[model samples]
Target: MDNITNEEKQQSIEAFQSVIRKSENALASMKSGSAQSRLLEKRLKAARIGEGLLAARWEGKELDVSHDELVEAKQVLEGLLLMLPGFLEKTKPGSGQRTYIERRIKAFQMAVSYLNE
Candidate 1:
């Protein structure tokens, strides 16, 4: 982070925003009880994992946990980083995407805050 150029950081931030918006829209537009609902559910889970990864990057100091907890967090973060690209490309975006994604992000923050305690 210290060595990252300003331009690079800005680019990363913009990419992060794009990923978030695309993933959220896709996750939210998915219809419940559809044949592919289960798959959509999985994609939502992966996006939440990505949200956690980004949050940890920007808020690492506030996220104190045990070594085992840290390990679990790292695994989730890595999984999100790996899965996000394919998931984003595969899922079609819709109007309702942001609502569900935002709800999940709030829930995720609550869950992780408990781990910190």
Candidate 2:
């Protein structure tokens, strides 16, 4: 594989920073009871699980064998991605919370794409 260029590395770093900012903002914005808030929580959980799986794969930890398991993971990720647009559309911008949720959802979508590849 070709080495990542300096510009590419910088972009990657910036993207990661953006995701962190977004997550922080989303957490701050969450309320105790609201549909949007609930959806955001659910999406965040899904993203975390996806991140865990990806991290495990990167660390060369072999997951237990099962065709059904792989299929379920993919299906769930896809379903979460599909739910993003609706959640994003409904969320209001208060204290920059919506922006953060949007960023996280986008990040999760990108992760799903990477996994598919």
Winning model by lDDT? 2
For candidate 1, write residues 41-66 as lDDT tens digits.
55445444434544565555443445
Per-model TM against the reference: 0.39, 0.46
Global lDDT of each candidate: 0.48, 0.56
TM-score of 2: 0.46
Cα RMSD to native, each candidate?
10.0, 7.3
Query: Residue 40 lDDT in model 1?
Result: 51
Per-residue lDDT tens digits for candidate 2, residues 12-47, read 334445544566578777785688766555545544
